[model samples]
Target: MSETRKCMVCGQIFKLRAQCPHQRYCSNRDCQRERKAQWQKLKVKSDPDYRENQRRAQTRWSELHPDYWRRYRDMHQAYKERNREQQRVRNSQSRQVAKMDVSVLDSRLCSGLYVLTHAVCGDVAKIGAWIVHLTVISDLPVESLKIAKR
Candidate 1:
C-alpha cells in the first residue's frame, strides 16, 4: 500500500511520516541547517516591504508584551551608560598627553570669587569673564559660585 512505502535513504519510513513532502535529508541536524540557511537567504533577498512587515511584527510583539519591552529598554540603556563610562575613562587617560592640571582656589582667599585657575596658564581671563557674564544674566545667584574644594 502507499502508506507502507519506504524512504530511499533511511529506508525505515513509517505511516504518515516526513512532515515536509520535499524533505530529502534524513538527519535532524542537516534538515535544521538547511532550513536555517534557506531562511537566511530569503531574508537577505527580501525587499523593503518585508522589512516593514518585520518592524510591524516587532511593534505588535512589544504592544503585547509591554513588560518585556520595558525591561529590554532598561537593560539596553544601562549597557549604553556602562560603555560610555568606560570610553570616558579611556579617553581621559589618552588626553593626559595635553591635559592641564586645574587648581581649586580657596573661596576665602579669592573673596568668594570662583576662579578656575589652570596650572598651564596663570589666569584664564576669558573663562573668568564668561562666568562673570553668566552670573549677571542668568537666574543662578552669584553666591552659588563659592569655590569649595571637592
Candidate 2:
C-alpha cells in the first residue's frame, strides 16, 4: 500500500485509490466543495475566451427557452413560496431600502415562429407565421435591416 497523502484543501490525510491516481482532497464534503471551486477559479483565470464562449452559449440557450424559469417556478410552487416567505422574514427584520432595477433592451432583431398544429389550421398557421415574419422584416428600412444583420 502507498503512503497516505495530505488533502490540498483541508490538509487531512487521505488514502489514494486505483480509480483516482491523483486524489488531492479527502472525503470531507467541505474539502470537496473547496477543491471544485479552486479548480473552476483557475480554469476561468487561465482561459480568456472561455468566459465569453460560455456567456454566448448561455444567451443562446435562454433565447431558445425564454419561459424556462417561469415554467420551473410554476411547477415548483411550494419551493417558490418558501423562498418568498424567507425573503419576507428577512425584509421584516431589516429596515426598508429602496432599490431601482435597471435593464437594457436589446436592439437586435429576431422573430419567433409559433405554429398551432391543429386539425383545421396546421398548414394555415405555418404559412401565416412565415408571411407575418416576412412582412415585418420587409417593413424595416434597408439601412435598419443592414444594421440589424450586423
Candidate 3:
C-alpha cells in the first residue's frame, strides 16, 4: 500500500506510485509539465553550468533554424499581434517593462539630443521613441539633425 499525497502542481490528492516514493507530481500531463517547468526554473537559478549549457543550446538551435520564429509568427497571427503589443510596452518602458497603459504616461516630448534607432517592420508604431539623458557623440547642433530635401 502507498501513502496518499497532495499534488504540488494541481493541488489534487493522489497516491504515490509504489515504485516512485518521492514523486511530487501525479500522473496528470499538466501536473507533470508544471513539475518539469518548476524543476527547470530551480535548476537554472541554482546551477550556473546548467544555465550556461541551456543558453548555448538555445543559441545553437536558433542559429540552426534562424527563420523558425518568423515562420511560426507568420502561421500564428494572434501570437504575432500579442508579441507586437508586448514589444510596444517594452519599448515604451524600456527602462522597466511592465503591464500598463501607455496613454496614461506623460505625452509631452522634450526637445533634447536623442538617439535614433531604426524600427523593425510592422512592430513599432509610427510615433518616435528615444532614450532619455542621451549623450551627444558629436559637436553638431541639434538643428543639424533635421533632413533637407534631397
Candidate 4:
C-alpha cells in the first residue's frame, strides 16, 4: 500500500494508486486537470522540442478537422451572442465619437464667428453676436458662410 500524499492543487490528502512515484496530485478531476496543465506549461517553457511537437500536432489536427470551429460556433450560441454584443458596443462608441465631431463643427457654424458672403449679391457681412440678425439685409445664404481671414 502506498503512503497517503497531499494534493498540491487542492491541499487535500489522497491515497496514491498510480505506479508513478512522483505523483504529487490527487485523482480528483479538477486536481488532475490542473496538474496536467501545470506540467504542460513548464514543459513548453523548458523544452523547445515539446513546444514544437505540440504546435505541429495542433496544426495537423486543424488541417484534419477543418469544420471543427464551424461546428463549435454552431453548438455554442452564447459565444456568438457575446461576440455580437461586443461588436455592437464597439460600433456605438465609434458612432458617438463621429457625432461629437460633427456637433462641434455645427456649434462653431451657429456661433457666427465666421464671415458670411452673399451668393446672389456678392456682398460680405461679419456674422457676430448681433450681426446674424441682419442676414436678410445682406441676403447671405446659410451655406455661403466662410471663415474670415485674420
- In the order shown, what is each candidate's alpha-carbon RMSD? 13.9, 19.3, 12.1, 12.4
Candidate 3, number of clashes: 0
lDDT of 1 by residue, 56-122 (tens): 9989998898798457757799877887899999998775333345444345443333334434543
- Quick one: how many clashes does candidate 4 have? 0
Among the numbered candidates, top lDDT falls to: 3
Model 4 CA lDDT for position 137: 32
Ranking 1 against 3 by lDDT, winner: 3
- Give the Cα-based TM-score of candidate 3 against the true structure: 0.57
> Between the candidate structures 2 and 3, which one is better when assessed by TM-score?
3
Judged by lDDT against the true structure, how good is candidate 4? 0.72
Cα-based lDDT for every prediction: 0.57, 0.68, 0.76, 0.72
Which stretch of 10 consecutive residues in model 2 shows the poorest summed lDDT? Answer: 125-134
Runs in model 1 lying further than 4 Å from the true structure: 1-34, 37-41, 69-150
Residue-level lDDT tens digits of model 3 in 1-150: 669999998899999988898988998999999989999999999999999999999999999999998899999999999999999987887745322334333455455455655534543443543323434454456676764558
Candidate number achieving the greatest TM-score relative to the actual structure: 3
lDDT of 3: 0.76
Model 2, 1-150: lDDT tens per residue?
A: 865899998787889877889888988999989988888788778887977786799999999999998999999999899989999999886533322342232466444323334243233322223212122335445544444333
Show the colliding residue pairs in model 3.
none
RMSD in angstroms between candidate 4 and the native structure over all alpha carbons:
12.4
TM-score-better candidate, 1 vs 2: 2
